[model samples]
Target: MGRSKLDVGEIYMAESKIDARIYSEEEYLALDSDLDVKYEYFDGRVIAMAGAARKHVSITGQAVTALNNQLRDTPCEAGSSDLRVQLEGTRNYLYPDVVVWCEESRWADKADNTLLTPLVLIEVLSASTGHRDGSYKLEIYKQISGLMDYLIVSQNRVYIE
Candidate 1:
């Protein structure tokens, strides 16, 4: 099946007004071949992800580096934003800014790119995504059984939680 294109907003907002149609998980996965674009699956709706800003990218990189260094010689390891995390048996798939897995890694697929378990997930918030990160994404990430820390860092400020 071909990917569905909807004329949503600028695609930079976290919560977009996609009223065209709700797509199935299979249809959403079929569009994954487009390397330049990323999509987040929420129930039956697919939301297009926008490219990160300069400060957001820098903060994510620094967090990954610092987390890796802090987790060195331990069981946990840091993964970049490309890592896809599944919400266990649910139909949700998201890309966190930085992730740390301490126990055995569980791959959602055979390719080992999708993760099913992670100990810590960090999201570097942007102006357009702050609300979603604090609300929708927060509720979803909390469903993870092994998640101990969920830090939402502000890219333009020094606040984090």
Candidate 2:
């Protein structure tokens, strides 16, 4: 399949749905590994992620920093957006802005890039992602047995849910 790469700092307004072709979990993972941009797998479709604005990046960084400080000397560790989280028992994989896990970390495979259990998942909302982050992704994330908190933070203002 033909694909276009977004340049750095280019803002993709919405989830770019891949062509009608359905991809298996393995296929998605294999394709994702070779790409520069990140994509989230939903069922059999892949949704291309949007570029983060300055505020989004700042909020995500601050959240991770704060979590790291509070989790120091503890069992928990914080992860940035580069971490891929797999929703167990499903083919879905998402990249939350920040993830914190208190338990022994679990990876989907030897690759170690895909995290299996995260206690806290944080999403720094942007204008393009606020709706999907709050609704569609929320329902899917709820299936994680070890998830204790799901935070939605607004980059436009001081708000969190």
Find the candidate with the highest lDDT and give its number.
Answer: 2
- Candidate 1 ranges with C-alpha deviation above 4 Å: 1-14, 17-19
- Per-candidate local distance difference test: 0.78, 0.79
TM-score of every prediction relative to native: 0.85, 0.86
The local distance difference test score of model 1 is 0.78
Instruction: Name model 2 segments beyond 4 Å from true.
Output: 1-16
Cα RMSD, each candidate: 6.5, 7.6
lDDT of 2 by residue, 28-137 (tens): 99877855888888776777776788878888898999999999999888988888999888878899999998658788889788889899999988877776788667
The worst-scoring run of ten residues by lDDT in candidate 2 lies at: 2-11
Each model's total of backbone clashes = 0, 0
TM-score of 2: 0.86
